[model samples]
Target: MSDEVVENDLIHCIYCNAGTVRFSEADMVSLLEKAREANSALGVTGMLLYEEGSFFQVLEGPAESVDALYEKIFRDKRHRRITKIIRESIEARNFSEWTMGYAGVTRQDLKEIEGLNDFFYTKKCFTELDPGRAKKLLEAFKDGNWRASLR
Candidate 1:
């Protein structure tokens, strides 16, 4: 048998019930580290999004390895409320470089998202949502856009 490895592009979304854990800077570091290990071990590459104290991580890699990694993640004590979004085969990785990336969404930001209709909010979840809606909603906020509001 040879040591050569086969690879494919598969996107995996691992959900986390972040409500149980307190969000902190230390937790951020640990989360990224685990993501890095998972990516390296499974030959996966993708990005992570944490919002409203929830985790939405996307990983792309070999079918078998990615599945195995997913199982491990589900079993990990640090991770709970695991929900595998979709693990279908894809032609390429959406976020082919980052081990993990973090974004902070404030209470006001949550309010903005909530104000959006179901159709618009769902699109923002996985699909490419129209920036117009985001702009409009942000404009409605007293603080303005995310950048300005977050500041």
Candidate 2:
């Protein structure tokens, strides 16, 4: 078989969830480290944003790998009420530069972003956000339009 990835071979998924509890800085660091290692091994690339106790993530890779990873995340006790916002085939990776790029967002940062609803700042999860809004948020992050500290 040819070792090549075509448009149909790739999928991108976006999801959001709330943390079971507030995570300390060290806890976040540890999470990022483990995620980076796991995603790199799976040939996945994505971005993760944490605001308060909520998480918004974008994962892109082979369909099988992405689906498997999403299943693992869905079952993890660290998260609650996981909601998938988008899943679709893509021609190229949106976050190809990072195994898992991350940002610790703040209320002020949310306020600075236009088009996001007021609810985004008060809620601990993004389950209510539509796919269009979620995609806009991801695009803003990808474009470095937000002031959140990213890594």
For all predictions, the C-alpha RMSD in Å is: 9.1, 3.5
**Model 2, span 67-136: residue lDDT tens:** 9999999998888888999999988887887899898877677666677757666654465777988987
Q: Local error of candidate 1 at 142, Å?
A: 28
Question: Please, what is the TM-score per model?
Answer: 0.60, 0.87
Worst 10 residues of 2 by lDDT: 141-150
Stretches of candidate 1 off by over 4 Å are 1-11, 14-18, 107-151
lDDT of 1: 0.53
- For each candidate, how many residue pairs have backbone atoms clashing (under 3 Å)? 0, 0
Model 2: what TM-score?
0.87
Cα lDDT of model 1 by residue, 37-60, tens digit:
767766776555455455545556
Best by lDDT: 2
